[model samples]
Target chain A: MGKINIIKKLSFTIVILLSSFLFIHIVNSQAELTSPTYKIVDPTVDSGGGRSESTSYSMLSSQGGALDDARLLSASYRIGSGFPNGIQANVPIFRCAESSTDSGSTNCINFPNANGAQGECGIPGCYDRFKVEINPSGNPIDTLYLVAIYNEDTNTQYFLQSDHTLDTTYDINDYMTICELEGKDTRTGSGCETGGDPNWDLSLQSSNVLNANANTNYTVKARALHGDFTESDWGSEAALTTESPTLVFDIDIGTTSAADTDGPYNISFGNLTAGVVNTPANQIWLDLGTNMQNGMTTYVKDLYTGLYNGTDTIPSQSEDLSVDAGSDGGFGLQIGSVAEDALGPLLEGTTYDLATNNIGTVTTSDTEIFSTDTLSTNVGPITNGRGGIILKALAVITTPGGVYTDTLTFTMIGNP
Target chain B: MNKFLFYTIFIFCTVFTFSNVNAQETGAVPTLFNTEPLEIPSEDNLDLIAPIVANEQINIESSIKLSPAVINLERGSSYLLKIENNTNVTKEFTIVKSAFEITSDRKLKKIDDVLEEKLVNELEESIIIEDELLVIEPYQFKNVSIEYKQPILNYLNGVIVKQRDLLENSDENQSKLDFSGQLASVIIDPTLTREQLDQLKNTITIEPEKSFFGIALNSKFKIKTNISNNSAKLLKISGDITLYDGETRIDSKSLTQNYPSYFYPNDEVSIEFDFNKDERSVFNQIGERSAVKTLKINGEVVQISDEIYVLPYKILVLLILLLSTLMITSFLGYRYYKSPKKSK
Candidate 1:
């Protein structure tokens, strides 16, 4: 009876040892299983001997073997998906590449091996391309990426799959391998075989994403499905910002003046002979520049209602002065023609066009004189922004002459 | 005898000619002076005819920038006005002070001549500038200190900083287009408090329209109400005249076309309303009825009420004539009855 108990105990010990070994092996295998790697691809770059707008995700075996049998069960991404927060939606990656095609194809394809050999994908840096489409509706161009699902049971990769085909119906037993590509080969003749492509870059558009406004920041992240439909942790967050808008404004003397030192601001209409129209030699020039979408406007007001010398005054006209010599005595301003600088095509106010020689009435109240509807070029060395203002005055025979003067204030506002 | 006469005539002619030449040379008898042709004043000769107005020849350039275009000056306080010379050459600016008032049309009416001598002197003394002349170097700036002393009243005044031509002579004929000086409005804060401002309302006087005594015979009648701003502060006056017949409002009309935007101190505006044919008829009816009529003139600060009697003098005259006729007839009849009966 003692011998029999010893035999049973030895057998129990062997069984325990074998069970422990099996459990440790399973745990080790799980610990070695790593999440897939993901990244955005720049269409402008010639990576993998091709250019395309796509997000690349790798799902290669640990042995660096082909992904012919190892397939992706599902793939998804989210914009402004910073770390710690879970990705809420899935974006499908379309299968644009056929067996005989290269990287130029519009669909997702696997990157070749270091030797530039085909059908030998799944090495490190050999990732499958997920196509991203740019949405042009918003101002900053929001982007939407497509998610793809590969059914390992059917041994088929689905192309152009919509959100409805996410394949969540599959059981967790449907396991798959996930891999990532880290580097691209950049060689002249050898092509992705000898060295990585130095020009290869990544952008938000390549990942099918964009900002809603100029000068705004955005974050992106991606998660991958692995064996048993287990989702790996999200990759490192990718942060970027959109470009900013610019606006510039300046004031200088119009080049039409005989003397540069005399003005850009002040205009003088010399002695007014009775029944004669007199215009200043120089005009006041206003320069403006902006990248604003809505454009800008300029307004002007006068300190005095008319040109006054002591009690004698030359009154401001109610309407645009006829400006005819020997007409009524009046004072006003005329907006000259538009002289475009680098970026131009500014417009004059409807009331004060110099073509008609109609010196528009300037009262104590503010009046619009010049405006523009879009981005304008900076005031260049060659007279730009727009033309200046020409002061016009006419004195009748009865106008008592002294030193007639008035001050005008110009104001400009921009809409960005 | 003919030879003797010829010689005598020749001698006399020669003597007269020599005597005239000698007289002209000796400055005793002057020959009718040969007059040079007069040159008519034309465009070419305008300069000779009259000294060209300096302003006409001047091409005024705005080279200087004056900041703080408007300021509120408190009594016993000082403010500095910055003047920037944008030119490379040295520039001189002259400060000119002028008294100004805002007109009803919102125009700046220079009242330099309208202000009393005492007020003008006070204004000149109250706002004292360190220097009326400012000389700034190339690309330099200068500040003019304006000190407001104890001011007697609030006034809207202007400080005109004119760019002086240092290169030109001061002669009036030396034409130089001077830079039309930039005007900085100096609004002197009133020395009076809110209570004082309210007290000024009592000084406003409104004269009622003249009472209509005679019958309303003309097609139209004039009702004039004179509103005077007797206070020291500027006021905006606007009101209406209401005609009442025994407390029953009959008619009302605006005293003036519009309220004077600025009713300056010591200024009077006449508010006249002309009664049309319909209005005259209403008054005539009132006169015939002998009803109590009142004219009330209302101003912004003052109101005046006066009784106007529009009596029907024509009807009264007719009634008197009728009574006299009846008396005369009765007297004649009595006399006829009392005296010797000469009845027929």
Candidate 2:
């Protein structure tokens, strides 16, 4: 009996210890798995159709370019929209019709041809439209005044008031206008002209203006505005700009090559660039360098990863990341995986922090620089500076394939 | 006995260590933010296009204005009748065709009210109702209709079920019950001239929210029209729904376009869809999670999404399996500790 008791006690103690270990492991894994560390940003609005506060969030755009063919083409019509932080407008909401020419102007209203018309309306694209509601009863003014318009395409979205501008032709299609963010306050039945109409297809009756207080509701429509004229409507009636804490971290894409010589690593299609000024209002863009695929749909999460060659080892595999290249020789390096893109799409202008794994600690007194500010986007390094970190590389096409490569760029605000 | 206990304990430790090593070796690395269905734009040749214009019907007060000034019809057998409106402006309206055939003795035999409506917007519109069984049994058919019309386009269409045709007062109209079906259609009649038999068709457009369907996720529901049409010709009906992950895109086997795609003057098409994340783990729903840590469905634009949330049942089942393994190991430990050389 005493032996049995002893065995039971031992077993109980062992079970308790094992259970505790398993419990801690499970909890840690579960927490790490469920918590979302990244936010998705899209251009949408608040209850009233007004400009949103500055969004500290990131953004992504639908693939923009030519349609399958100017005549009778039925490809996926993707247009650009302003998505601030944490909003995924992936659903195809509206369609747009535009002339097949380079102008991309003179298109019909959203979602036009249902049965697929015969080459009638020209090139087709789509835009995302956001509807907002406003009430101006309590505060001071009877009429609320604000600026509203569909801003142009942005690659890098940032937080700086000086970076804003009123460039009219930024969006895929110049659909919405710079009207009052708040609509005119009017009586229930009175007809009022609500501003933002680039196409002016207001067949629906008027009097629906978004007030500062419960007077009317206006729709700040985001249109992919594809030429099919069969555009979709992203029904977002709330403000997208909300003050949120921003994170900052050193995002570096490293390569492996001999020192003092141009390495195999290419910044040719990279999407990051210097800060952009004179862009549209309420719209942000980030251009890492044009390694992204043309007409290929992109996402917020895809914008979060860093591209590194497998030859250069990363600190940990648990790194929050994603990739789309075609090679896999090293830990992170692969051929098709590192999508090579054209240089034209990645020109926003931002300083890049470039580095390579092959260039070990610089011990020599002799420092080197590429001399020219512009690097050879096609072959060798156009320019490389001392300390090996600050390589002010220009946007170039390194690969023959026009693959646009991009990864998520983040900054963990605090000193880590 | 003490030696046996030590040996069993040693065996358990060895087994646990080996299992841990194996798990680490075979475990797949998890990539973040690769959830959400991939947006693989259809690579098919179906030539699918997006819808142009859309609107929701609100505050509609519609009625059917029948002319020949509400005449009485014969009792037995079904009859084809035409509804004519003498109104001037372009007014939107719905028609509710109901009938009851009386026996030869002038008594009602069977009755069925097939309540349906069509939004007719032109100056005049005509509809045909085929071999409708009005009465229950022993009765042929009687043609009857309840039509109401208001000049404005904002008033909603109203329906009323009546047992007998008694030209009563307007107060009796309150007895009519409102309906859920709202009629939506494009007025496609180009002909005018104050005609009495003009035929107009309903333009129906059906579209899915996303090009691809999600595995174990609610499919993109098809948006449809509610208007009914009997004389309109359905034209230009074709749409393609394609699926794609970051890697490959899969198109629907075929696009189905058989007329009267569910709404009235009926031409709208409807569909709900999702795509398979992995073919290997397709049947393994229990404790089975998507290998795609970051999933993107790219059509024109890439939709980045993630699915780290494992189903509760899957977690529970995994826990149970783990617990069973622990129990079995413990049982063996206990048995070996209690019995010595005799078992050996």
Candidate 3:
């Protein structure tokens, strides 16, 4: 009887042990299973009208020195056949230029200035042709709303307002949704990748629709908008603009007459993150440590492997370095990675490596050497038990004169 | 203790359960995409000599404007219109046609080029919504066409008479809303003299398959005959279709005409038709989707050499569907033995 009882107990133990083992095995297998996907990490910014449809007038800056002078400009709208059969014309909203002068006007050509004068416009008669003689003095270096032109044919007239351009004129921010550049994030959880997700928010960004003068230049800036209690931090102020070396420490630097000196710098990353998590990250990660500036900081890191495989010498993706509020106040990693929205799953325990084949620094004439760092962590903490480790680095841009553009590379390794 | 046995049991159970769902539905409803048929209505008693025109040039003595000529009809309707310029100088004609409303808020794109500005200025000068008909100079054909649903009586009247004209033709316009002229006229014949009845019987034979010039391929014609109570009727009539390849009967078919009972003195009864093409026929491909062909019935000329379209794609698709259905039925029969309920 005693022997029989012992045997029964042993069998029970074996069964329980086997079931537990299988359960653990299934979880482990799931966590280890990750699929990587390629994504368009970043979109390109319009440098200025100078590149493609530049005009001699655009080359003229009012800031003196190498800067060209601002001249009077005119614009008009001829409705195409697509116009609706019947719709009352509504006056367009205008954002006044900051000036108006022979050299340059800070006021918008179509917008009214302080003291009842339209700064951007010099000619007082027709709204279509806003002839404002502009001097380059006191130009708004940040992104400015010039004017929103709405041609309502029914009213046979148009209205103009300054501050209500976005609400009254049209929803310009929604334009990104029509363009393929924007996408969603379809990841499973915080770290683990499922399919993909829609782009976080398309309403925050606005695209330029106005036709710049043949010779005129337009400058734009990216304003940081964060959730409540969130602040923006950068890896390096030097990394804000692609003209790194020339504008290296000069937080305010201009690329052309049409472009303002104050803008976010673009850092390019190569195509290293294939569809699987085993591949490299599209952006090179560097540790800026906990100590960093509040708004925008910069970091330089070297990607040791998988860099040369990129199409051009410069990387393809761009970064939008900002601060993550709830997380530690470090510059939120702004690297464009593979379309996480498209990936199947981003399992934990996956070690994503970095590629450094064609990695280099950008300067006006000469090139500079940079360093890289790598870190790894077990996927944990997150509900999905999938977390990733990121590293960062920094380099001081020295070369001056022309603009600078460079690339960073990294790779990821998934569990077997 | 018995891993192999356990594995076998699992496989057997899975197979059994999956197979025993005897009422399993198979085959999916295939996705079908069909273009809305193009519809071109004939106005002013002008018969459609051709439903579709190709590379051929045409000349119209006087300019013809279709208010909404080219109608992108429902899935089964399509329309096409042609205009020929018989004169010398280049003629400019405006073709105003639009598809179903693509968007609710219709807005035109604003362009700034010289030509665009000129067009805008020109448009600003014109206040009327009438679709302009421009004919280019000499010998150039221009088709003023549009594709749209025929509006209701109220809308049609508005289109015919402008707001200003509505005031001028107020009482006379009352006829516009009258449905008598709106509905097509029909003629019926019965209780006619012996000779008249014979003539009617002979004339009411099956209509040979006919097609419009230069339009569809592999065309099959459906003939409809209407008999009115005022016209003479015959008891028996037989007719045969004669396909002519330049005065030759390549194929033929015969059928006896049937008449409905109790044809009132003025009441009209109509017979509809569905025609199938006879495979054993000889013809050559003429223009795009067109074939030059001719048809006759009972030694009477029904159609001269005209362009007939051979819709090979439609026929091929139909055949594929028929073949697929057969194959699926056979496959289902072969799998019947796999069910355990039946096996037991």
How much of the real interface does each model capture, measured as fnat?
A: 0.00, 0.00, 0.00
Q: Write the per-residue lDDT of candidate 3 for residues A1-416, one digit (tens) a residue.
A: 99867766775666566556655644432332234863321111111111111344222111111111122111221111110101112111112221112113222222222211111111111111222111111212121222323222222211222211111232222211111111111223312112223433221111112111111122221111122221111100000000000000111112221222211212232212222111122222111110000001121222311122223221212121121122211111222221111111222111222232211222121111111111132110001011122322221122121221222211110000
Cα lDDT of model 1 by residue, A1-416, tens digit: 89867766765665566556645644432332234673321111111111112268322211111111123122322221111112222221211212112222222222321111011211000111221221111111112222333333344433221211122223222221111111221223312223233423221112211112233333323333422222433432323232222222233454462324432234456667777767666566555433222334555667566787768777766444554443558877777756643333567877677555567777666566766553344211111354577777777888886777666655443321
Model 2 chain B, TM? 0.20
Tens digits of lDDT, candidate 2, B1-344: 45655665676576555443323222211111222111222333112122222221110111111111111122222222222111122222233332212222211111211212223331112222342222211111123442222221311222212111112121321211111111111111111222211232222232333322332322222322222223222222222333333333322211222222111223334333344333433223322222121111110111122232222344455678999999999998888777875476
Error of 1 at A338 (Å): 2.6
Q: Indicate the worst ten consecutive residues by lDDT in candidate 1 chain B.
A: B51-60
Candidate 2 per-residue lDDT, tens place, A120-234, comes to 1111111111222222212122222122323222322211011111222232222322122213323332223333533222211111111111111212223222233323333
Docking class of 2: incorrect
TM per candidate: 0.30, 0.16, 0.13
Comparing chain B with the reference, what is the TM-score for each candidate?
Answer: 0.36, 0.20, 0.21
Q: What is the lDDT of residue A26 in candidate 3?
A: 40
Which ranges of candidate 2 are over 4 A from the true structure? A1-135, A139-416, B1-262, B271-314, B317-321, B334-344
